[model samples]
Target: MSGATTPGLPRLGDLAWAPALDHPELLAPTVAEALRAWAGRDDRVRDLVAVTEIDPDHADTATLNDMHGLPPEASANCVVVAGRRGDVEQVAACVVTAATFADVNTRVRKLLDARKASFLPMDRATAESGMEYGGITPVGLPAGWRVLVDSRFAAPDVLALMGSGVRRSKLLMPGELLCAMPGVEVVEGLGVAR
Candidate 1:
């Protein structure tokens, strides 16, 4: 029997294959620039590569688990949340493994220092960030949001998934870069148990 592709998942071959097969060297221009700016202070973020992938409408982490063929416990993602403060909209980026949730109502809220932190509207998130819906990455966000990465993703040479600037692509980068981001504070155990 032939292997069939799942609805929200694309085969590895379907990606924009980089012939070099480099793991964390394929970041998008926006992500690359952001990482460079961050590298001035922390060196760990330089090893990351932003990835693009298929539109994953699924909100839960299981979707990523199935798409990447990763165990539910081994996958990690950077979740972006946007809100308003004093008439200015702000964004917050949080990283969590597939097995855990970011706890937007609690952790992300406190991190952003917002009275109320909620997921950004898909349209607004895409339009303001200059990235496609479902493909938002913290690397290219407009200069309004505060970016915070969880230290759990700071492991060297570890693979972390992000948006590809498009619905059909996802970005992958080294986990260490998550710690090296400018203003990136490594909070202890920020991820919520699933």
Candidate 2:
């Protein structure tokens, strides 16, 4: 793919993208499985999703965007949050644009019905999610985990750039696609300007 600048790709940088299913090395084992399953069930997903290699050191949103000279809003970020009420343990994956952060203290806390909420520890997050520490994504989260997506991604034409469940590569798809992924809840106040 010569200078492949697809919708979700950076405008100022050249990234070689290939179908995600064709590059297992770019995904964590669980993420690869989830993608294959999603693609098998929905043909369009198999055709539209793409992945591109990157320096693992640039996996963080700030660094990755800076490396590509991408606008802050060009990508989405995911974080795993956990809180509890009574005997029930609540865990969720919150998604928001890079320009904003998840509203964990107010909006998400209220939604989870917890007195307080905080990001899950890095080690625990990766162990339970079967993904890398810096590359947690909502796409392949556990079935019992709640997935919250910011409502700002309502526009179907907008691209959703996110980790491919690993630090060495990134996933790119239409925002609508990620919002419609299995067990996703699109919330209006999920994101707050940073």
Candidate 3:
């Protein structure tokens, strides 16, 4: 599977991308399932998304982008947040470009209408999401968790490299595809320039 390129692999200059199926070891079960579902439902998504493996140690967006010669803006980071209002608890996944940061404390809090909002503890995040802490993606999060995508991802044909629920590989797909996922809410300024 080393050099084989499938329809799902986009032509990212200098990036050695392969079909997500070729690197199953890098994906959590939920993530792989979601990819398959997307591919089955939409030919465009199947043709636009791809996967590539990397050293697990370099999985963080900044280091991975730098090491892989990918522009920082081409990568998106997924962060899990937890909020509480009275007796209710809410969780959300926020997606933002590497060059920006999520507006968690303010916009997120307002959106959730919670009295308090903060990053979920790593252990709890990994346990509840069934994904590695550093490799969480919005694709397969549990039902009911709102996915907040930055409006910057709405641009046509723009690719965003994101985690595949494991640190050893990354998914590359059009940002528009991400926005189209169920329960995804695209909000302007959700990602503030850093």
Candidate achieving the largest TM-score:
3
Evaluated with lDDT, which candidate comes out highest?
Answer: 3
Q: By lDDT, is 1 or 3 better?
A: 3
Per-prediction CA RMSD (Å): 7.1, 2.4, 1.5
Q: Write the per-residue lDDT of candidate 2 for residues 19-77, one digit (tens) a residue.
A: 77878888988889988988887876776788888999989888888788766674879
Please state the error at residue 25 of candidate 2 in Å. 1.4
What are the per-residue Cα lDDT tens digits for candidate 3 across 39-146?
A: 687776666767887789999877877776888777889999988999999999999999999999999988889999999999998998889978999988988789
Clashes of 1: 15
Over 1-194, each residue of candidate 1 has an lDDT whose tens digit, in order, gives: 11332232222323442311132334445655665566566543333343433445742346755755655533556667865556765687666776677788887777666778887777876676767655566666667567666667776645566565554556555566555555566766668887
Where does the lowest 10-residue lDDT sum fall in candidate 1?
1-10
Model 1 segments more than 4 A misplaced: 1-29, 32-64, 83-89
Name the 10 consecutive residues with the lowest summed lDDT in model 2: 4-13
lDDT of each: 0.57, 0.82, 0.84
Superposed by TM-score, candidate 2 places the C-alpha of residue 40 at a distance from the truth, in angstroms, of: 2.0
Against the true structure, candidate 1 has what lDDT? Answer: 0.57
Stretches off by above 4 angstroms in model 3 are: none
